[model samples]
Target: MKNILHVFRHDLRRATSNVMAVIVLFGLVVIPSLFTWFNVIASWNPFENTKNLTVAVANTDEGYQSDLVPIRLNVGEQVLSALRANNDLNWVITSEDEAIDGTKSGEYYAAIVLPPTFSADMMTFYSNGSEHTKIEYYTNEKKNALAPKITEQGAGEVSTSINEVFTEKLSEVALNIITSLSGYLDDADTQATLSRLQARVSGVAAQLRAASTTADMFTSLIASSRPLVDSASGLVSTSGDALQDATGALGTGKDAAQSLKDVLTSTTVALGDARSGTADSYQAVADSVDDVFSSMNAQSASSADALGAAATRVQTQIDQHQQLRDTLVNDVRPLLPESAVDSFDRAVSRIDASIARQQDLHDRLDHAATHITDTDADVQAMHAEITGLIANAKASVDDAQSAYTGSLQPKLDALAETLSVIGGDVDSIGSDLSSVAESLSGSDSLTTALEHAESLTTDISSTLTETADRFDALANALTKAMDTGDLSELTEVIGADPQALATHLAEPVSLKRVPVYSVVSFGAAMTPLYTVLALWVGALLISVSIRVDPPQGAASDLPVLTPTQTYLGRFGIFALVGFLQSSLVCLGSVLFTQVQPEHPFLLILTGWVMSLVFTLIVYTFVVTFGNAGKALAVLMLVVQISTSGGAYPLQVLPQWFQNISPFLPATHAVNAMRSAIAGIYQNDFWVSLGLLAAFALPALLLGLVLRLPLIGFNQKLLRALASTKLM
Candidate 1:
């Protein structure tokens, strides 16, 4: 430890005592400071001078005229007028050819040219399938790296200004139209016309009210008739059922008529036979009576007349039954299915044949009575034949009576009951239909009320049409009257402050930027990086100018120093120079330039620590490996400069650079200084300082522990370089 102190003091004295050494030491201190100060002053406020970047402007608009607007619009001229007042960039007005040539030849940073159809396109806002108004922007990107970016921002400003102007103009036109409309509304003539229109509309409304009243009456009529309609439908259905029953009854009556016809037919045939047999008997009996009673011939004549009269009565009975059957068949025939018509007709024919047979029998009986004047021989035979004939006629009459009572009479009674039911249903249906028809024809029926409502509605529609036409004519008259007055009076009537409104509409939103840990200028914000670079470069200058090892003779007066002692003693001199360099660079930043740090002491302390760490690293490498170590130090500086997040953020660097950035000493130094300059957040300043100080440990190991073992090899390397006759 004594040896280390002795060597450190001895080297310090030698470096200060000589004039050349003091001058060289002074130069070393100022060199690193100059590097940082020059850069800081150069970049103090770069964007403030961007107005000097030239951008060419060319206007080629032909202007547009609108028939409805009564004005000629030239958007290109408006843009040029706006650019003249803007100082964000240097706007040079020229022809299109000149602008393009200037931009290409690097005389201008960028060029903006309006097309010939620019104003016409702007006026096509309400037109279909229109092209957008375009301002062609051309940039000479090769002019300067940042010139294009600045000029691009200028082009964006130009676009924004154009939008504001266009919006302000549209708002003005709309406000003027609204002002005219307000004047029209205030006109007394227009108000009178509107009053008349309102009166007409009221009349239409009265008509609608009358129509609504009629509609209500119609609705009530419909509601009342619903039950009647249902009853009528039921009555019609019942009538159909009853008619069906009547048809069945007709079928029954037809069968009864058929049975009666059959009985009459059998009775007729039986009577015919009885008459033929009794005719012979009557002739013989008449002859016998004539012979036996010559003196009583008058009695025989009376009996013969009696026999003829009885035969005539039987014929009258047969004709009456035939006529009744014929009437029943004819009535039932129309009601029966078409298929039963032929059968009913045949029954009628059979009844006619039966009547004919009865008529012939009557004729035969009358002829037999008239021929009874002839004499006969047998009286007993005549009496027996007469008795047999009476018995057969009586039996035929009794059989017919039984058939009529059992089959025909009961069927006829059923048919009458069915017909009575049908008559009652038909009467009910007729009553229902009469009631419906009366309701329909009545004054307050649904159909009548609907017709009245329709009439009222048609009148209301016509009245509304006439009112609309009057309103249109009134509006046209009011427009012409208002147009005859001075248009400027409209704006006065509207009572609007156009200047205030236009200003608000043009730039409605004002941005208030609230900066966090705000930096005053570009150079001040860049102080951390430049300060860090100065510290490392200061260490490099020290390494190159001063030796890393103690002089062999000067250190001999002290006891033989161990490698650790030797390494510390030599590092003490380098560390002092690094401290001096860091102080001048950090203090000069705020003192000489415009850099104002939140914690000036912390900023200086960060620089001091970073300089020490950087010096130890370079000194260790040089001490351990001789000249090769200096080259290694230079390479390390290059890597740290690129990856240290100095000029640009570490995030913006390549992946490899970012990956190695955390391990570099400059990375932590820049971070710590930024915290101090920008106002510390959390423990960032302390943490970054701690990381930067950590580099000293590994540097101490390389110089003290590792340098001892490589001393021989390092000496050989130095000797070999010397032998090459170059360094």
Candidate 2:
């Protein structure tokens, strides 16, 4: 210990006694500090100002003039304007050829060329759906890693902005149209239009009534002609045969009418049955969906209940832990010896903090779960209501079909029976006339009767012809008015529930976003990890040049110094230099950048501690292994770069890296710094600090204590330096 102290005092005096040596000593601290500071500063938030990197934009897009919209769509122009406004990229307006050539010549980081049909393809969104418009993003990887990456990011940003603007504008237009339509549907003009249609339908019904009246008049004429035909049969027996043939035709007509009536009745019944079945099926589906919803509700409730119970248990455990911690801290700690009290209180505090962290996580989990179940319940209730609406519609259809069948079927049956009776009367009259014609074949009034019968038949046939004409005119008029009825019903339905109709037509499904945490920006998220890596690398870089062994210019008449004295004396200087370098870098970042660490003092203190720890470990390697240690330190830097979880998460890496990460000083440094920066010192914060202390203390001890015993290994350092001639 005395020799180590002697060497330290001797070295400090040698360096300070001479003016040149003093200048060199000051240079050692200032040079590394400046090197770390300026280099880190140059790269700090490098992407923050990407305005210098040029990206050529060639927009050869034509505007699409849509008939549906008043304005022409020029998405390319909008994108170009947005690019100009945005500071993320230096967007240069140029031709395609120029853009391509510039990217090839490294004048631009990337080139984006829009096709001529960009707006035309985008306009198709209203007609069909989203159509992808290709904006050619040409990147030159040879420009360097970052430039290509940044340019691609810029291109992606432009694409997203274009999509957002187009979607927003389209939504606005559609919503405006819907709003206007809703007002128009509610206006008095809509009711007038519907009333006109209903009046037209009423006029059509009147035509049907006229057709029926004509048919009834024709039936009366048929009954009246039965007597005339009967009277003439006796006068002209052969003409009576013609009457018979007419009566048979009537029979055929009656059969056809009966068949039509039966068909109508059966069809009505079938439709009613179909409606009933559809209603039943719809009900079944609703029931099934409801059952599943109930099951989901039950499951969610069970999960929430379990989580709540678990929360209660965790709270109980926390209460118990709090009681113990409070007892140990306030009551028992004071009674314990001074040495035991500090450690006991620290242990109790760590346990209490860990418990609190666990409790917070559990409570949040339970709360989120509870909210999830509640939302699910609400969604399920909405689904049930929608199902009920569908069921009610089905029931309405069933009732309509049933009512129509009940009222119209019997009327058709009665009409068919009336036609059958008319046919029977014609047949019976023809039969009676046949008997009378044979009996009265020689009567004197035969010619007069035959003429009268012929005249009556002619008049009856004319009446039938007029009846057919009337039916034809009525059918055509009814056909025209039926269209008006359909239109009226449609208008009425839309006018009644335009809001629901519009909502359903616009978006059948919706996306609900539930945010859990505020998204942190890239700069804020990466600051802590990068600071840790930079501090460690900065320590490694400068420590290599600072020698840990006694200088050849030291007093030669003194006793030879052991390796412990050499290692300690050299480490004191390295530690001081490393501390200055790391502290300057951190302070510079804090002063210059927008780094707002939660615990500002803790950030500086942790950084300084990390510097001391890293300096000791690195100082050990340099002193014990000499130039071989420098190679090892460089190798360590490479390894730590990958395994440190500085950029990517450790779990995402290979298993070997994850297994080794917990032991690495960089890991703990980054973890502690992140907690300090984010103001979230969870259970891992103190553990990382402890690990850092554990690494630093043991390393420092081993470097000084083991340096004497490992003299053989120290001698090999000289051999490695001489034989390999390595630096």
Q: Which ten residues in a row have the lowest lDDT in candidate 2?
A: 485-494
Q: Relative to the unseen true structure, what is the C-alpha lDDT of residue 690 in candidate 2, on a scale of 0 to 100? A: 73
Mark the regions of model 1 whose C-alpha exceeds 4 Å error after superposition: 176-496, 553-558
**Candidate 2: pairs in clash:** 234-437
Give per-residue CA lDDT, model 2, range 491-558, as digits (tens).
34334445455445445467799744222345555665666666566666656545566654444534
Q: What is the TM-score of each candidate against the true structure?
A: 0.58, 0.48
- Tens-digit lDDT string for candidate 1 (356-389): 5555545645654665554553333443444454
Q: How much is 6 displaced in model 2, in angstroms? A: 3.1
Q: Candidate 1, 286: how far from true, in Å? A: 83
lDDT of each: 0.72, 0.64
- RMSD, each candidate, Å? 22.1, 46.3
